[model samples]
Target: MKLRSKIYLYSSVLFAVLLVIMNLAIYYIFSTLSVDNQLDRADAEAAKIAADMRRAGSEVSAPELLRAYVPIEGMLRLYAGDGSGPAPVTSAAEGELSTLKPVFYNEKHSEIIRVDGRSYAFISIPVIWVDGSVMNVQMTQSLESTMDTLGVLRLVLAGTTVFALLPLLLSSRVLSGLIMRPIVQMTATMREIKQSGKFRRLTLDETSKDELVEMGQTFNEMIALLESNYVKQEKFVSDASHELRTPLTVIESYASLLKRRGLAHPELFTESVEAIHSEAIRMKELTEQLLLLAKHHEHWNLSMKVIDLEELVRDSAKVFRNAYGREVTVKVKGEVKGYSDEAKLRQLLFIFLDNARKYSDDDIYVSLEASGQERLITVVDRGIGIPRDELPKIFDRFYRVDESRGRKQGGAGLGLSLAAEIAAAIGARLSMDSVEGAGTSVSITIAAGSGE
Candidate 1:
């Protein structure tokens, strides 16, 4: 069955069963109390009749006394000690007792009995008779009054039980609607997303802190994350194609020239081959950078360990001096020990140094120090600094402030982007500041807790 129908059916059945059981319990208790009350009244009446008979011993005839003490629809019977004497002394009665013979008791006694398929309340006591002998008096009343009253009660209870279900079933429908409302809305939102080819989220009520609202919130977050990744993926592909097209066109042109003039024009053949090789190397570098940028930082398997920031800085500077013969000055302040992935940290430092080396001709300065709970490594260079407007876009892949200068510098504009990825992978913060005429300062901050 559909969820709504199943909800309605199960809820209604549960309420109905509970209501019937409650009514049955009420009926059972009430019937017991009613029958007991009837028996008590008959017992009390029997006591009063016996007292009167004893006080009037020999002063009145049995028939006359019985006539005055006759019950409404009950009986009063007197029997001698053994019940083998004269006939039973009984007043007018309503029900027959052909199947019952009750025993007499010394003190007052009361009981319920069944005779001729009808119920009765029987009370017996010993009393002094008109003959000055002890006699046994039996009083019995039919249970017709109790049965009639109980019959009325049964009808009322059954009616209440059945009628109570009307509101219960109605409330079940309302409850089902309340429960299924969010589910239906979510389905509709999904359908809209499918048809419109765009991600959609459920409208949420902030005040309601139920699971249904939490579900909608989770769905919205997931959709937002997916949309963000999708936009980034599309932009990455578009930029990659644009960047690759230029080098590919250069290589193709040079290849065509080599194919046409290589055997005849020796100098032209050498120039063409050189051009093709240069573009081919640039293409290879661009492809490698693109692959690095494509992988998210979270997927990189980092080998985290404690590294001496001071030593790492001096080592990087020494490598730069050997490779480019550019003098790099290194300074260490306070304790420079930090927990991080050493290889990724070194790569991040090298990207900033490369950028500084390209833009500046003066000596490059590197500082390693500890401030508060973080390890700060700053790289400063006296190069042709970046303009203030281009600082924000510096970390975007393939974004260059001056494309001509950037191409001549052998920079595909992805060094800082790769630096950013490395910094993220090692849980470090990368920031940069520069002026057009002045130099640029790049800093990497590794907080103490970042290692964990």
Candidate 2:
């Protein structure tokens, strides 16, 4: 069965069982106690009659005394043992009363008896008869009134049980609905997303803090993440195509030109060859960066260890300067240490230094220092700095400061974005401060080695 139905069925059954047990207990206790009360009242009346007979001391006539003390609706009798008696004294001589027979017994006692489908309670007490002989006074009272009262009680209890079930069923249905509402909404939202090919979220009730609300919030978070990844994927494909078109067109055109006129013109052949080669190399670099950018953060495999920041920076800069033949100034403010992946940190440095080299002709300054508990590395360049407004977007993948210059310089604008990823992977902070015309400086702050 569906969850709503199951909840309703199970709860109803449980309530029914509990209600039955409770009502049965009430009925049983009431019946037992009421019967005992009837017996107690009968015994009290028998004792009172015995006392009156003793007080009479044979002065009062037996028949007159019996008539005066007989119950309003029951029989009072005197039995002298051996089947002999003064006779039964009863208020009513007709119907069930005429059938009752009093018996003489040795001790005072009481009992309940049923006669002709009617219940009766009687108590027998040994007493001196007014004539000076030992006799038994038996008081018998009908249980009709108590039985009628019990009948009425049963009716009330049955009606109450039936009435109570209405509320139980109603509350169970309402509670089931409350529990299933979120799941139903979530299912509907999923259907909409599938049909429309877009992300959708549940409308939450923020006033309630429960597991259902938590489930809705988690679903919304998952949708948000999915939408973000989808947008990134689309942007990557579009930008890749845009970047590849220029180089592909150049290569295709140069090959077509070579086929048509390269044999007749040597300089035309050299120019076409140079242009094709340059575009091909730029295309290759762009493709490589695109592959690197496509990797998710969790998939990045980092080999972490304690490495001297000063040494890594010096070695990286030495390689950078030798390859590009650029003037690089290095400064060390004592020894700097950090826990990081050395190769990725070196790549991060290269991205900043290369950007500086592209925009400036003067010396690029690299500094390493220990500041409090953190190691700080900064690279400064006298380059044309970015506009302050564009700083936030600089690290976004495929974002560029100078689009035309970037194409000519063979930079795909993915360097800073990759640098950001690497810095995050190694638990470091990367930031840049720049003036529009003066220069740009990038810094990385990392905790000192805690060898884990």
Indicate which candidate wins on TM-score: 1
lDDT of 2 by residue, 162-266 (tens): 999999999989988988898889889999999999889889989989999999999999889999989988997888898899899999999999999999988
* True-vs-predicted CA distance for residue 89, candidate 1, Å: 7.6
Model 1, residue 443: C-alpha shift (Å): 2.3
Candidate 1 weakest lDDT stretch, 10 residues: 83-92
Candidate 1 — which residues are off by over 4 angstroms?
21-71, 74-93, 103-146, 203-218, 268-274, 292-299, 384-417, 448-452
lDDT at residue 191 of model 1 (Cα atoms): 92
What lDDT score belongs to each candidate, Candidate 1 first? 0.82, 0.86
Tens digit of per-residue lDDT, candidate 1, span 105-199: 66767888776667789888888776677777777778987888899999999999879999999999998888888888888988998899788
TM-score of each: 0.78, 0.76
Model 2 CA deviation exceeding 4 Å by range: 1-144, 164-185, 198-225, 266-277
TM-score, predicted candidate 1 vs. hidden true structure: 0.78
